[model samples]
Target chain A: MSAQTLYDKLWASHVVREEADGTCLLYIDRHLVHEVTSPQAFEGLKLANRPLWRKDSVVSTADHNTPTDHWDQGIQDPISRLQVETLDANIAEFGARAYFPFKDPGQGIVHVMGPEQGATLPGMTVVCGDSHTSTHGAFGALAHGIGTSEVEHVMATQCLVAKKSKNMRVAVTGKLGDGVTAKDVALAVIGVIGTAGGTGYAIEFAGEAIAGLSVEGRMTLCNMAIEAGARSGLVAVDDKTIAYVQDRPLSPKGEAWDKAVAYWRTLVSDEGAHFDHEVVLDGAAIVPQLTWGTSPEMVVGIDGKVPDPAKEADPVKRAGMLRALEYMGLTAGTPMQEIGVDVVFIGSCTNSRIEDLREAAAVARGRKKAATVKRVLVVPGSGLVKRQAEAEGLDKVFTEAGFEWREPGCSMCLAMNADRLASGERCASTSNRNFEGRQGQGGRTHLVSPAMAAAAAVTGRFADVRTLA
Target chain B: MKAFTTLDALVCPLDRANVDTDAIIPKQFLKSIKRSGFGPNLFDEWRYLDHGEPGMDNAARPQNPDFVLNFPRYRGAEILLARENFGCGSSREHAPWALDDYGFRAVIAPSFADIFFSNSYKNGLLPIVLPAEVVDRLFAECEAKEGYRLTVDLPAQQVVTPDGTAFGFEITEHRKRCLLGGLDEIGLTLLHAADIRAFEEKRRADQPWLFA
Candidate 1:
């Protein structure tokens, strides 16, 4: 009986070479790219006049800078248009396929579209130049973000040099209470561990709470794994994972499916797996979380109070609290429940899945958005998610509640697309990262779960959605 | 560019928490990638006013008295004082490029988001991590004196004031070696050139079918 943590097992099997200072070169199975970071690397390739090392193993997409509205073949923003066009030309020239333009059924946020379209599989290592590449860990793959140069390196050579990080397991037990979603679970883990707690670690999600989540929910949980400061977050593939990818367009078929399932089923860490460190949380105890400060770690349950600057006994932490208060126009000890929201956004790779939409729609079923709330945007993660939501009439529910059911893409996730918060508007967002001015200049963002976003939309303040039901 | 290193330089002007990449470089200016001209646009909105275009010497301007970075004491700065979640949002490496291009050698913060933090390190910029209490003291000291200079020694794992006040910080030895060597990922790759070439030859020999 082999007793090993998932991280140790994964790292040991994948180790190609060990470097000085304890870094190991691990092989990468898949490499994904996007418009924002690919230009330079392609330029590097062009400079070298080298054909890509392998085209089949690499994929590209245009998501970060693409708008979610009607696909304008001629986009208005020249920078965005050129980047997209340049990438298109490069991919065509390289014989690499790329998902481009509006609402590509294969086109959605790269992280979401990758797994939904079966581009991501379990027991594989995936890397994207974008940080949220950790999102694919839901399928039990060790996925992490890489630099643009590394992207080119991987394009030129499929293998990557990686340091073997410490393995940690975060076990969240107990069933989630009503109004809590996968976004809440991820936020709860991050709040307890703080952002950098997982530094130099690969965290595995396990225990009853994680096992209970569906595949889409699992994706949401793993999407912001980087938020916890882990190199990647992974969950062992299970029936739920297999079911999700089984019938997808690009998934392995017939005999290939059998081989994939056989391999995936073997990916689970053995029982009694030992981890270097362990953290535990009870899902039932978690409330709707909202980030009151700039960092994702500076979060408290919706029913909690803003931390007192003085209470942060360490001077550096206290200074951080004070500065956060200044940027947020919030005071220490202010009740999070009393905070009012100027805008409500319920999309992003974090919470743009169909399950997130269903949860928001369930909350907004018979309700009208509060009069004070100015904007409510519901951007789905992928065209598939959008199509499924429309089939279920979830879009109608959102529209009736005064929310705009937008097309698929990474809309307003980082304000890379046209979607953004006007300056000074405090927004309740279902996205990760509430850094000061993340949405726009001087714009404040309070990160929360989708239901909380819907609740904020209905009442125009950071109200507790758990209490609404 | 006389071998200017982030070590012994760079401190935050305002002790701010969550000084995002946008604050490092606002979104509107992410329109190009020439890599030669982002310095003028760094902190464009905060340092300039209605009448000021990007090219003017921002330090000479009346300056937005209300802007967090424009406090009187920390003018002509090299160091930045920041709090947790510094450099959150979009993975555009350009954010750090703008800061590095615009004369920022180092950022002293209690914490940083993972992507931005790693990006900063790779771009020949130093990101110093000090305890929250130590960071607060630096902020207060920078605030107290006009043009107070702070020095950071990467090899010593300490930050010092002009008056020789020293504070210890944390960094992994691997990162220290990388920064001290001025090695980017390319440099990392070049280190293993022999091993890579040998591996390529071996792989080709083992799988003759894979080659042209």
Candidate 2:
């Protein structure tokens, strides 16, 4: 056997058949579905008169369109209500291994809920209709997003038609600075490697800085892989990964657990493995990061200034920067810290776990949200995460500091629900994307870490968390 | 999925890089369960001056005059010419769905995001990747002249400009065949039911805990 990358090993083990053209029918171990992308897929299945190949292979929830603030009011928007109801009806007719419908104690963002429930495990292939399915790759799983057509294909047959992705290694060595977290590391990686740098490749985040992160932190890094144009990202399994998967409801018990652990231990890449592309970054040099522009790649350290398009040599890139500046209402050479924010959103699949909430709450413990800031929303990733935050008094800390402690849903992340930004309203968000009109039709979103979002909430500007006394 | 063989259509040059899916079709319109009807809302925010919602009368909305799609010269354009890393955001297939519904049979770009590239093929929207220099030339030609159209011959794997300059593009034979024949991927994969079952059985024995 030749030395192989972890991605190669995972790819080989899952291959059911390989066509002459190099397309492989890869087996999917778990499928996570949500409201937004699954409806059309379900409709496709029904139109084709196809039955779900293996119902037990699926776990579903309604997160993207569910209201975060007013569950008691019961989804005021009629269209949003119908979408959630459609998911419930589809799951009832199609069946699933597990389902956490809206208001279910276990319900949360699919990416956050899957790993927390142990449904996303090591050395298996996980997929979802949502792009952030890469978040599950933190467990050393081969996970990626599939379009609705592929989603229907997976439902009809428990296999995905896939081609092997090139292997890319992003090695971040040295120690991270104080107040710099996984979100910063993820943003820094994107800043260094343009969004298309990892296209057609699966990136493995390794080295000392990666090894030092908690599993939740690893997920945050992997969640942003799609933003960098890669469909999937991975971290090799270790003691931390095993501990994270240890005793969840879906995890193997007793003898099975020991066997699973042994298998997972071999999930790392073999020495002398060849990679198609490689990038290296120093963790110590990475500061708290924020996207001053619309694209994730358009990020800079909090201490940096908004980029001037005139300095950009490439006309296409310069035009893009100019458009972003106009849309974000930013000026060239303006210090990032001086930019004010109207809203602070500290939730998304990217950073809404208990660890993220704890980080944000630590920054908001005694401080008040700035009077200039209109609203500060702190949404937990899952109902379980919300309960855990409440248990630790994190919710109280946020509420006392003038933040709205909301329910577990995507909320303003995509703003499919009522929680959204008004036109021209600038927001400091912990969500994955800062694309134009992402939060709302004309909203301006600046991507940052949970702690960074909290810092922005307190000061009503892009404040450096490290400078917070 | 519609079979895409050849297209010689007017080009609508959207000279932008990293156009994300959120901008392609806003999240607000994603509430619809059906795939159709997304065309009217395609590039919703960029095309219209006001906010767009599902079921809104698109004809009544004031069109952004500066938007290239609204230009009278590019009216009924069926091909979109774009910059690098087109369709570079969330994995909402709605981007391609919207483009296809809006009468775009093909899109030519310097590069494309992996997921969007694959999704485009599944929806019968040919995403042609050309060299950056070639794409730049095409954008220049498209912008310099009105009613400029390109002929995309997928079977020949070439995109021909009106001036007889043809640029070849690369695509996997498997994807090309699927698109040419309008094949159903799931139906085709199900042809190997026995192989899938055997592999599953072996996987269950090798990693029993996964089943447990």
Candidate 3:
């Protein structure tokens, strides 16, 4: 038999039909929805006068624009209120499987909640209206983001007509150094392959370094795969994946669980599987990484100096570097550790899991927030994660260190809510995307891992977590 | 959906690289799900000098004289010419919606992020991928001549300047057909409704527990 990559295996099994033009009608096992993108999609369904094809497969939530502070006080922003209310109405009318509204125990970021409830499973195709839907691929599911129009298409048809993506395997070899987390590996990969390098490919993370990551770590790795311009990122189903899924709230049980695991065990690529592109990284060489510029690709080691735009040969790249430096208030040759921050944000879909909180708490356990830092916010990805953190006293540690413990939502990541950075306020953020005004209008965001953000919170600068230890 | 057969319109050269969606439509303007009102807020941060909130009268906002869109010569332009990696962040279909709403029928760039490229086509906005040198040439021409116009013939897959210089591009036949026919994807999928129903029935029996 010919060799098949894991992506090919997953694509073939879910394809209902392949057309002459190379587009395949792929079956979607789960469809996740959030407030910001679904209203127009639901309106499309109404215009077509069609019912949802598979209500049982859809889960809806209000996350993107939900305020982290005073969420129960009722969303004060009228526009945000309308968007969230629209989702509640759309779900009720469409007969969605579950709708986690604001203040619900399960309410949180859609990508984070999907895996926690086991709606995302191995060998399935999961999709959401938001791009970070790639996060669910950590469960070995073929997951990716869809545009709002495609969201409407899926809601109406329960399928997506997608082109089969080329397979690329990024193998991280060697053992990771101390204080180097999965977030570091992700940043390292993005640094190696510039933001647009993975375009039109579905990446499979493989090899020893990947094998050592926990499910949460793998989720962090896959979460940023979109930042690399790959819509989907995957890791083959392993014991860690199975362990994470087994006995979860929505996972199959008893005989059904046995049948499911049996199928999942076969989800790995063939022994001689071929990939169209391969990138092998020496994991030992990676240090704690942080983005110094606007793009995810503009990263350096925590101790590295800021790059001078004059050194950049490409005129376009040089212009970008100059703009970023001016906006970020950074100077050429300034070490990252000397860059002071006005705020520290340590949670997002990328790093708000329990494991991420534990890592952050370890660094913030016995420290006080630097006087130079005006504010620090620690938000969990989901209410469940928040409760779990409080149970383990991680929340207490954060609050004791002058960090405000906030409710779960996509807060400060994009800052759609009121919790936003004022203009020119620099932040060491654990969220993805450092694009101009991503956190707020005229605000500057420096992307880092949760541990790095926590360390920055205590030190008021981009401090390497290893040095603090 | 509007049929996109050909477009002959004035070109606005946005000489920038990696023009992300956050810049295309800022986060503050993302609160509305209606999708129609985003035209005024397109490039909100760059186009206006003051902060823009929802329900604020766009006409009252102070226009940034430095922005390309505010220049009188580029006014009423329906085509955009830009540098590489345009529309590089977020899967907000609103980015394309804002362009379409603002009367842009096509975007010609050296390259585009995949999701934005896909979203552009789906929203009846033609995104033309030209070589970087060709894009640079177009940018130069647009700057040198005010109200510079380009004629894009979708069927011919070519963009022709006023001086008759032409640059050919490529598009998948499937996408081209959908655009030419003004076909709605949901309506087309409904044609296979019976087959979808049959597949779902068989799938349920094969994995009954999945329904739970």
Candidate 4:
């Protein structure tokens, strides 16, 4: 019905065949599983008395359930432990490679680890059990989250019943300011586009600012692309992307390297390629932003006031905003900067990369932790990042500034481990999602950039770090 | 698995709207790619909480006698009466598996979460959406009575009740065929084996340098 927008071309090329029922059976190039969703799939296989179809195609990691504090024990929480252990057994049984127990260099959030290890190559279709799996699209891949049933389906048969999605290219130009991080840019785009604007489409993130971001930051931006209801998000691989992958363990060497780069260079949208929809945002126009409501879309710049639900164009949205405000203990006209936070979390697949840490450390220098702030934790995304940062004294800087330099793990992203906001407490975070009770029951979350998070740790409120710097 | 359809008898309790998938299987249970374990954790908070069954408390306790699935009235329910926008979060296949594993054949709601709605048909879990008033009527009628039964015919796109009442359901023509034909991932692939083999062979020859 439309000219190929990279998505159609990819889908049409990858379609192994069409089922008699008219559903097309597409082959999956990669299947990444995490501790949270792999247990059931492995158990299902056991129940069916079958082994993994292609054990090598499957990749497993223990992130959601493992704790940064303990390496000897798998996880402290029973629920987290159960899921992680389930994944471990499943992978062991099927002979799939798994990164587990601790956030060693090989283990981190599935999306982060995949790219860092060069497993997320260009032109591949990646699906994981986590919604943020869209993060892989930063490498020019078609990636999205799949369900447990779909996971089992892929395991039993490396195929998926996929519907063709429309292509959308969102462009944001200009240079980002001193303090605004990739998270802010992403939040601003979603805020303007609304949460469901990209529904039924795969987003291609292009333009100068997007192209300027480091590979990890690009991944962080694409990670939340699904938040806007897009199938996935991508940037055409460039020098930055190629440089990031050159030294990775799985990256090709010598002869293979030349071939890989040549193919990777071809992963861009051809000229005159049309997108179903488009949105353009000027990067320099945005300030540091955060979410004050339950959804990521109800975001306001740090200097702005909480939106009045009464002004919302839709009734359902209005009611939702009101509910979010009530839960967040805020009212209309409340300045977002004045909001005090009890804790500050600087981790998640979204912002735990080395660049994110360095950005926060730059703000944390010469700044002491707030006496009123209960906890300021900085968890690196992977052991490699942790080791690299520590070697560079980044960890020392964070710790000296009263931040807890925790081990590499998905700490404080969810209550999967020991790090979680106590009920009724408010936190400044770098992770995506601010849904009610998302962190913990009755806990409030304000999604911000890493610099803003560090600033929150210093000032105990959402402050504009650029001014402080 | 056998396929059958009817929707007239499907009924749920008081209107619980916007049933997101996080509340269905939850982000907590999504750590693995497996589907079976989620059945136990389906609505883990709701199923064990007082809100779900009216008299349950202390979800952490070993015994909660008043949970919804533990209730007598809703026992052996083939059709599920759900609130609006059920299954609204991440396109995980586990949501449908959890629902299907728990023995729900069809989920009737005013609206369905987009991803979950698509996944339901693939997993053989029929998701039916009717007008809010119509759904409310069915829920009320069932609550007023008991053992409400609704039947759905995928080919006909209709749901039939015990008293000969009939209601039409909507589905994409393609998905409707998928459900009726009882096709799954492997089944779909097998149906196109010849074409797939040819495509693979041709690609292998055309891109000989690319194969590993």
| Model 2 chain A lowest lDDT segment of ten | A68-77
Question: Over the stretch A13-118, how does candidate 3's per-residue lDDT look in tens digits?
Answer: 7777767888777888899999998999999889879899899899877888888887658999888999999999988888877778999999989988888988
On DockQ, the candidate that comes out on top is 2
lDDT of 4 by residue, B1-212 (tens): 33544334434452454556655765555554344545656665556532221122434534344555656787677678866656655666767877888777888887765567767876788888888777877877777787777767777887776676778877766677656767554555556657655765675564332233
Candidate 4 residue lDDT tens string, A325-361:
9989999988888889999999998999889999999
Instruction: List the DockQ of the predictions in order.
Output: 0.26, 0.85, 0.72, 0.32
Worst 10 residues of 1 chain A by lDDT: A95-104
The top-ranked prediction according to lDDT is 2
* Per-residue alpha-carbon lDDT of candidate 2 for residues A1-469, written as tens digits (9 for 90 to 100): 9999999999999999998989999999999999989999899898889999889889999999998886898988899889999999999999998999999999999999999999999999999998999998888999999999999999998999999999999999999989999999999999988899889999999999999999999999999998888899999999999999999989889988998899999999999999999999999999999999999999999999999999999999999999999999999999999999999999999999999999999999999999999999999999999999999999999999999999999999999988999999999999999999899878999999999999999998999999995
Candidate 3 docking category? medium
Candidate 3 or 2, higher DockQ: 2
Ranking by DockQ: 2, 3, 4, 1
Q: What is candidate 1's lDDT per residue for A129-211, written digit by digit as tens?
A: 88788889898888988766567777765666566778888899999888888888898898898877887678899989899
Give per-residue lDDT, candidate 3, residue A97.
Answer: 77
- Score each candidate by Cα lDDT: 0.75, 0.93, 0.90, 0.75
Candidate 2, superposed: residue stretches over 4 Å from native: none
lDDT of 4 at A451: 89
Candidate order, lDDT descending: 2, 3, 1, 4
Model 4 spans with C-alpha error above 4 angstroms? A1-3, A19-22, A97-104, B1-4, B13-19, B27-86, B91-94, B97-105, B108-114, B129-153, B159-174, B181-184, B191-212
Where model 3 places Cα greater than 4 Å from the true spot, the runs are: none
